[model samples]
Each structure stands twice: as structure tokens, then as C-alpha cells.
Target: MTPRPAKGGRAPAMSTEQRREMIVRATIPLLIEQGSSVTTRRIAQAAGIGEGTVFRVFTDKEELLDACVAEAMDPGTSLAEIRSIPLDQPLAARLTQAAEALRAHVDRIGAVMGALHATEGRSRAAGRPGTKSPDRQAGMNAATDAIAGLFAPEEDSLRLPPRQLAQLFFGLLFTSSIQESPQDIGPVVDVFLHGALASTG
Candidate 1:
């Protein structure tokens, strides 16, 4: 369940990580629906805390956004499921399952990259000189690495590199537009399993 601040204008004493996680989790929906336009006021309302509490927990709005990206990137919930993929399954079957899982993950964090991008459009966020923050890059790299681990067991039969395939698959997932999406992801998986080349015999 979503967390709410304690009653009587008092917040329960929460550790640093606890407060950060609560704020990030509360902000997740706002980020998805509103992108970078989400404000601390909205986050505060969602979190059931005073607006000042947000700054107390984070140095500034940029830091809050940074933490949100990190939270979104963490595979803690899904890592176990990915690792549990049955090795005996056919490569295609396994990959399709991976695709489905990845799709759900992408949907969960829809437009998160866009939010980060839009935020940076104003100016570079803390912790990096580039358009994207190091935290964002770290999160992305961690997600790709976890996905690659899923493909490792089947690497012996894969012509394309597992990690490369993981990266490409996620790239497609991330950039996919909701309105432009097909009726289902099956066709996308089909294309991934078999690309532009066709049988000419």
C-alpha cells in the first residue's frame, strides 16, 4: 500500500533510506503521468507530508528526481523472477518470457527517461556533466546487466551476444510509445526472435 504521513502534522521518525524510499515510491505515479513537470507540492501531497519535508529528505528537487531514477532502476522486485527462469525452456520461450517481464518493467517506469531528459533540458542535474546524471546511467547499466544475466544460461546457442541483445531489447521497450504500440507485444517478440532476413530457398 502507498504510504501516508502520520496524523497530527507529525511524521513518524524514519531513517534516511526509509524516508527517501517513501518519497520516491509516492512520486513514481506522478512522474509517469506528468513527466518532469511533477512538482514537490504534488509529491508532498502524494506522500502525505509537508512540502518542506521533501527538501529535508533531499537537498533539492534535482536530488529527489535523481533518487527517483535510482529507485525506478532498482530490479530488487524482479531480480528473483528473472533468475528463476527455467533453463530447460526453449531459447525462444525463455526470451519471450524475458520480453514480457521487461515490458512490464518498462510500463512500470513509462516516460521516466523522458522526465529525466525534460528535467535536464532546464539544466544539468547534480552528479554529472552530461545531459544525464550518473545515477541515471548507473541505474540503466544495472538494469541491462540484470537482463543479461537472464540470457547467460542460453548464450551457448545465441548468435547475437546476450548482453547486446538485452540492450537492444530494452532500447526498443524504452522507446516504445503507448499509442503506437501494437495490439500486443507478441509480434515484437517475434521480430526479435527473427529479424528482417527471410528464407529465400
Candidate 2:
């Protein structure tokens, strides 16, 4: 028979996967703030679970760090944000929104990886392969496709096809040193939409 709750009610039971997700979510901020030095006691406190529970979900801290890196690198959230931009919005507005989302996605990956590298002194985070990995390539393709969708409504006005335009736009984003602020990003979008040369009357 299942044991009854004490005076106060107990939280709902979580499956092994659910517990792992909970621990990872709680640990991400700590990893950013403390890097690989973040201790299991702190993680348990943050997760509101016993220290042993963390080990039950992951073999060790290295495994947990790998999970955090995976979450940071995943492009699903950014793609959803880009895809949700309304097609009715002007081309510039749509691209600006997409740019912001993509920049934030890149920033997140950098932050998590930077923190881990600072403490670990490794070229790449444990368990994450090179960018040439199939999973990483697939994520890059998905992000480009999502950005390409933004140009669909303005296909006639554009000189190049939407997919090619997207590849260029994405390249510009990754190659250039863009700040997080919208003000900084707006001019870049403007330059992309219109040539750098001044238009004469």
C-alpha cells in the first residue's frame, strides 16, 4: 500500500524524466552564475529535491552539464518565436523580430558554453560534438527555414528568392558583431533591405 501524506500535503509525484527536466531547469541559472563549480547540494536546494534525487536522474555532474548544453543549443524555442511573427506585419518589422529572436538564441548558447568553458577549460563542452554533427546541422537548417518564411509575403518585391535571402540574412547575423538592443539591430536590417549607398532624387 502507498504511504499516506503527513500533516501537510505532498507535491505531486514526478516520473524519472520529469525529475531530470526539473533538475536541469533549476541548474541552468546556477550553471550560468557558477559554471561547473555549481554543487549538487545547491542544485538539490534549487530543485526542491533531496541531493540523492539528482544522482538518480543523472550519473554525475558531467552528465548534468551535458544536458544543460543540449537544452541551450536546441533551436526549437527560437524557431517557434520566429514562426509566430505575423505575416501581415511589414517586411522590415518581420525581419527585425526574427533577428531579435535569433540573436537571443545565439546569446543563450554562448552564455551557457562560456560559463562551462571558464571553469572547465575545455575546447568544447563534454558530450557536445563539433558543429558538423548531424543534430547541429539539422538545427541550423531548421533555423534558416524559419527565417525564410518571413520573406514569403514580400517575394515579388525581393530581387533574390526567399531561401537565398534567408541564407544571406542568417550569414550576416552570425558573421557580424551585433548587440542585443533593438536600436543596434534596426540599422542592420535597414542596410540589408536597402543598399548602403544613398538614393538620389
Candidate 3:
């Protein structure tokens, strides 16, 4: 028979990266809700780990906030979600789903950056200048390509190429103040598919 271990044995240890990921995941919502004012103690409570665990994973709160910023900016998750949209759906419905995913992506970046700006006096950069860093440009290109995939099936019916339409779609999304309702995306998709001109028929 195998020997029994002590009743009060400690839990198995997690690797450093695993611990950091856990803490960062827990902290993101708190940062969105409480901004930079969220405390390490609170983060520890949220992760169900001791306060010192966070310090062991991250050198300090600022370093942890930096990790959060990096996480918020990474487009991998959003791209995966957009790619998973079923292609058999109607063109409008597909685009709307993509739009919603992109919008949520933008919102996450905004919330984290807004929180950082509030406490760090950091300036939120504006506009797509020619000087965008290579990584930023690459991410944008990936997002555009993902959006373009939604238009692939309708290519023969489209007046413009899928890539160009994708760029135009991004333009509309950035300019329009879309809300968290299916109704809001309807008009945006309609405008993109048709036009802003009133029907004269």
C-alpha cells in the first residue's frame, strides 16, 4: 500500500509564468472597474492568493500594470474570435459579428490605457501616423486581414476588393459611436452594404 501524506500538505507549486498569468488575468477586470487605483491586496484577494505572491511574480505594481497593458493590446484573442465566425451567415450578420469583436477589442485597449493615463499622466496617442511601430502596424494589418476574410464569399458581388472593403469597414467602425446592441450594428452594416442616400424608389 502507498504511504499517505500529511493531512495539511501545501498545494502544488505553479511555475513563474503561470503565476504571473493568473495574477494578470485577475487584475484586468479590477483595472477596468477600479482603474490604476486598484491595490495589490485587492488583486491578491481576487486571485485567491496571498499578497506576496503577486510581488514574487512581478517586481512591482507598475511592472504588473505594464503586463496588463501588453495583454490588453495583444490582438491574438480578438483575431481568433473573428476567425471563428461562421462563414455561412449572411454578409451583414457576419460583418456585424466581426464589428462587435473588434469593438470589444478597442474597448479593452481604451479602458486599460485610460486607467493608465489617469494615474501616470500618459498621453493617449491619436491617429494613424506613418511612424507607427512595426509591431503596431503588423497587428493592424492582421486585424484588417481577418475582417477581409468575412467578405471572401461575397467577392463576386462586391464592387470593391475584399481588402479595400475591409479598410472602409474599419474606417466606419473607428468613426461611428457603436453601442453594445445588435440594433446599432444593423445601420452600420446597412450603410456599408448599401449607402447613406435615401431610397428614391
Cα lDDT tens digits, model 2, 89-164, are 9988999999999888888888888988899722244454532222877888898899899998988888998889
TM-score ranking from best candidate downward: 2, 3, 1
Instruction: Please provide TM-scores, in order, for all candidate models, with all chains considered together.
Output: 0.58, 0.86, 0.82
Candidate 2 Cα outliers beyond 4 Å, as residue runs: 1-12, 121-134
Those runs of model 1 whose alpha carbons end farther than 4 Å from true positions after fitting are 1-12, 73-80, 86-91, 104-110, 116-184, 188-201
**Tens digits of per-residue lDDT for model 1 on 77-179?**
6655666778788666665666666666655554676665665522223444432544656656766776777677778888888789889877875565533
* Candidate closer to the true structure by lDDT (higher is better), 1 or 2: 2
Tens-place lDDT per residue, model 3, 1-201, is: 223454687555677888888899999899877777899999999999999999988887867777777778789889999999999999999998898888888888888888767766222322123222227888889999999999989889889999999999989977887685657888999999889998899
Q: Cα lDDT of model 2 overall?
A: 0.83
Q: Candidate 3, which ten residues in sequence have the lowest lDDT sum?
A: 122-131
Q: Judged by lDDT, which candidate is best? A: 2
Top model number, TM-score: 2
CA lDDT of each candidate?
Answer: 0.69, 0.83, 0.82
Give candidate 3's whole-model lDDT. Answer: 0.82
Task: Tell how far residue 69 is off in model 3, in angstroms.
Answer: 1.0
